[model samples]
Target: MSVDPKTRPPRASAVRKAVQVAPTAVGAFYATSMETFRCMFKRPFHAREFVQQAWFIAGVSIMPALLMAIPFCMMFVYQINILLAEIGAVDLSGAGAGVAIIREIGPVVTVLVVAGAGSTAICADLGSRTIREEIDAMKVLGIDPIQRLVVPRVLASTLIGMFLNGLVSAVGLVGGYIATVYMQGASPGQYVTAISILTKLPDFLVSEVKAAVFGLLAGLVACHLGLNAKGGPKGVGDAVNQTVVFSFLLLFLANSVITTLALH
Candidate 1:
């Protein structure tokens, strides 16, 4: 005998709802993020929240940024020095390092650090607040969570992404200097000289723009996932995992598109 329509499980309906709602959710997230950015330009600036988030994103990301910078710097500089040595172009290794570090590696590594560390923290914090009903309380109190919480995180992450790009580039170049000058016995003067000769304004600006876009992507994903989290305690954990995966996926895609367009 067939079950009554009212008595039947809602599994199929739930699946349909999920499929339909997913796109709407994405669109809503994007719209809300843009609105948040716009709101930040208005009065009643949340200086306390903005400064706190900036500190959290930048301060907590520093160690990981350095860790990533050091290893990649050494590896890439070593490889470039070896190749330059083979061609007796060792003096230009600094220029090669500068180009690679500033144009690609610096922004990519810095954004990864922010996503893996800063985004995780934001997801967890917001997810916890969501599950604990603090977000609902905010709504009850007539508070706009997007204006108060979201804009700061997104703006802070973007600005921090830009800052970290510069920081990582500096560290990477320093490592390149040591590798080329100390490890390979290339002259310090030539290593420093070539960087100025090879890199210019456009490379620096492109890197900064890439980092800012990456940051905005990280913040948007983290905030969206965190706010929409469900299923209680386990859901928060899952949302954090999804945040990392989604952030990295979008970041790489954005990086590829930006690099292609900017370079062309």
Candidate 2:
């Protein structure tokens, strides 16, 4: 009644692999994150460099998304206005649409855009370097890869995320305004007043923080996958793809948690 090895349960082997890999991956992620954070503080804080990188990652890369976002924001406001008009509650349309865009949708959408652009770039850059053995070469030169490579990226991304969120929020609001006021013939002063009354400092601050966290998550995930990639060119592509997917998942998860805790 002895079972053949081939027919034996696969659960044990699967569990073993999971047990071995999961902790190692988790440990590596944390270790790299900590190293990146430490390096961020120790390095010379160049405001010019930070601003330049921030402009590229957050500002320049945001144009395409912003262009696309404008019409969507307008459509959303138009729909909300129509619904409110039908309900004889047209006055609430401005506040309702404004709050929805600024507090939640704007930051979330901006980060998604940033993840698609900036995060992908980060992943590809690091993955290429990793495949070329540049990371290893840095180690040979006694330079810490995390310090030299990961820190600036993480910091730049965090700042960029915040900046982009603000930019998107502003742009979306203007789009909403144009749709609600100019297109719908809503009172300009009323629209402005509604937004002013509905939007609070706390909402904006929370959204900004969420964007920053999202940036850090995106950068760190991309760096982790890229640095750990294997199999050369194919590996680089795989890592870039995984980085985008994982970053997007983590960003949404983090957003849910933050919104639940901070906003609620």
TM-score of each: 0.89, 0.87
Number of the predicted model whose lDDT against the real structure is largest: 1
Judge candidate 1 against the unseen true structure and give its global Cα lDDT, from 0 to 1.
0.90
Show the lowest summed lDDT stretch of 10 residues, model 2. Answer: 43-52
Cα displacement (angstroms), candidate 1, residue 84, comes to 1.9
Evaluate candidate 1 by giving its C-alpha RMSD to the native, one decimal. 4.3
* Per-candidate local distance difference test: 0.90, 0.83
Q: Pick the candidate with the highest TM-score.
A: 1
Residue by residue across 36-65, what tens digits does model 1's lDDT show?
778888777788998999998888999999
Q: For model 2, how does the per-residue alpha-carbon lDDT over 167-259 read when each residue is reduced to its tens digit?
A: 888888889889988899888777777886787888899899898899999889988887998898899898888887888888999999998
